[model samples]
Target: MKFSTAAIMAFPAALLLAWQAAAAPGQGPDAETRAWWTITEALSNDRMEGRDTGSAGYDRAAQLVADKFKAAGLKPLGDKGSWFQPVAMNEIAIERAGIGVGDRPLVFLQDITVDPSNAMPVTVDAPLAYRGYCGAAALGDVRGKIVICHGVNRPGLPGAAERIAAVKAAGGIGLATIADPGFAIEPPRWPFAYARSVTLANASPDTDGFLRLRLKADALKKAIGDHGPDAGDLIAKGSAGEPLPGFDIRESFHATFTVKRRQITSSNVIGLLPGSDPASTDQAIVLSAHLDGYGFGTPVNGDGLYNGTLDDAAYVALLIRVAEQRRGKGYRRPVIFAAFTGEEKGLLGSTWFVAHPTLPRTSIAANINLDQLRPIFPLDLLTVHALDDTSLGDDVRAVANGMNIAVQHDPEPARNLLRRSDQWPFLQAGIPATAFVFGYRPGTESERIYRQWYRTGYHTPLDDPHQHIDWKAAADFNRFFKTLVERVADQEAAPAWKAGSSLRPAGH
Candidate 1:
């Protein structure tokens, strides 16, 4: 698969000037700095366990945020007349299970992590065929075949599934996604899965004829090779050629898991900054960031909370700041400041929010989502993803150009960061949305910083509120954000998608 290099365009000199620019009339986020830190600290405190959506801990966090909004004198746009916008949700936490090739069992949690997806009558005698990542073309056929692919494949092979897909396109079916899945989200890689069943699955889906391979190390290495720089560092994937040893048990490889499905409740904390104009109040610009994190993974500083400090904890703070700014401005359009939950569980929070919207969907002009941000990135430039087909992309570009920061589109399409964040729900609803993430690696030092973050901090209990932030960078970003919103909000017309653009709202 071809990869798009991340576009890192520099800002015009004027953008740099804005950092030190005179307040153009009114050019600063309201002086709610204390409020910013309080919200950030509270939601990310060790007690919350990373605020896993639907958890009691997250409920407490939500109540606190709503209280803060109420204290700020903001109103709820929700139907029920309260600032708290309840986002209905279904939460599933797969207990544990066992999978084995023979009498010898494959490691669980270590060598594999399976999603108790669905139940199949414990059948005996399954066949063999290992599919590739890209599917068929590079891998081979695997229909009614027991396939063995890597958890993470590497070099000299297109990856069994990629080959399998190629073959599938040429006519192939019944595939499985295997990879050495990890549980950390520090530097934030892929989610750990015994099998990558679907691009995105809803609730308890089928799991018969489908299986994710979590193989034994010896077999794994032969299948995937050492995961070194030479492995899949730059290109290729986990999957290689290995004939299935004519090994078959008269009965099927029986696997049992204590999978329980439960309906969980989480929320989207929404507060409205109603605009001065009643006509526009019905429509609004939404600011969103997920508030959930992988709670209870590794311990951080003796604290057990998966406090999503930077993942979205920071963005949540930013959302409040924006709300404060809009309320103060006596703005002309309703601005929805939403804190989403269940992002770690597949954008569930945002999905729930959109599906059970407090306001009409058509009135939602656009969404500005903040997933993760760091101080090191040059604050002078504004980086956004999913720029294609939206006028907002141009609005951002124009503002970036006017501000002098070069705008950029995502270089990596395969990653599909667009569909991955909270922005997708609105995007799917036909309203245009975009997200901002802080990412740029100039050299080894930067790489080291991100690496250490992933290994030692991300998704761990260690992700705490104690770490100091680059206050200046935070201020600068909020400044740019202020400008971006002012530009969008002040416009006499709502931002539109370019014709034939994939992002255009339905019936546009």
Candidate 2:
């Protein structure tokens, strides 16, 4: 069959429209559902290239989000009458990496993972010291030496990052940490060559070190060779919450790394829906979701695009649906919809937004952010992050109860999800904030589905829109989200921090 260029170009949209129409009798999902589907399909399309921050694909996704905001009657709340608030960053990629001891070459991505931010050809040949959990006393004689450390031994112990900083301050030349069992290296998601690292240009350090890498446990053990406790023994003790005494390991590690750095700009897409009530219009509610995902990288299953269908594309779609549904409506306070960029790169966009807010900083009342909430199963339970930290938890419970859905606190605190998403920036700025994840009790079918999704697709190219999702569950959450926003916006006063709440930053 022969087809014209126009016909080929029109196929996807026409097919999607047909699917929408076929789902109903000559009418499709109401405007809200159609709105959600259209935005999700457009953003997740292969052509968008997974919306990696600072890439052309990310620019296209940002534009799409801005257009949706404009079409939904949202007031542009970005810089100088623009929908884009520019964020400056530096992108770093590893060009060369190798580690060796004596004449033995330790494999990359197997025996070790290097810090790509290290200056090219970072030749480090230094003495080695084993600093267990890096207490102030443990950091002795770190000058000009490579420091090996156990990962966190308990929740309150100094973590790997903290230990690295201390070692660097004490003049350590290199840092390597044993993989924390769940670190990115052991199961190796992408190949070693696919390094796409980014850091904020404003926060760039004046000096760089052979920062840190994940050293394979067995490989480290072989290197120590009875000079110190075995790597596996240290890890087992750390994993079991036991502390170990610091000692010197009799070995010197050598490594060289090459990296390429480039300055780039990405943006956060912000829009505002002004409230109807004169009294409350001064304060606003913010809804946020990230628009960036891992772009093209080392191919997995011969696919390199990390199309974040659920990781964020879905929730960004939800934000659009809510904005479209609430246009010209009667909420008492304004609502700000922010599609953040560089979330995968340490919540850069939201951090920048909070630091340089378009609105008066104190006037922003609360933030309800969304990241990846897999709706693969029914929507019977919702897990609210930082639920006990502020009054926003009460609001979530009230809204979920009205919808007949049970609300729960973060069930897995060890994941430290509370401090991981875009919402954390708002909370840090002393604004009441929280985020949601679909909840599942242990050993249930819902738990099974959630775990399987995480194990298989969480950050991979496999998270594309072609994967399974319960559309009805999405619609249900959309309804619940809309009601929550409306109620919070219409409340008599701005959401408040509970007295004595640990999250209430000093003088907030």
Best by lDDT: 2
For model 1 the TM-score comes to 0.75
Worst 10 residues of 2 by lDDT: 184-193
What does candidate 2 score on TM? 0.83
Q: Write the per-residue lDDT of candidate 2 for residues 1-508, one digit (tens) a residue.
A: 4445355335443242243224322222466666787789889889899998898998998999999899889989999999999999988876667777656677776577765663524577777777767766678888887777766535777776688778888888777776554432112233332555677778856356456766666676755656677677886776565777677766677777676788999999999998888888667999999999887765655777888888789889898888877664647888899999999989999999999998898789899998858877779999988788887788888989988899887777656788889999999899999889888887785775576565457777777877666666777888888888887888887888888888779988
lDDT of each: 0.58, 0.77
Off by over 4 Å in 2: 1-35, 109-111, 116-121, 127-143, 152-158, 165-171, 182-197, 204-210, 216-252
State which candidate has the highest TM-score.
2
Q: Write the per-residue lDDT of candidate 1 for residues 10-92, one digit (tens) a residue.
A: 32222322332332123323355556767788778877767776778888777877776766667865548976666554433
lDDT computed for candidate 2: 0.77
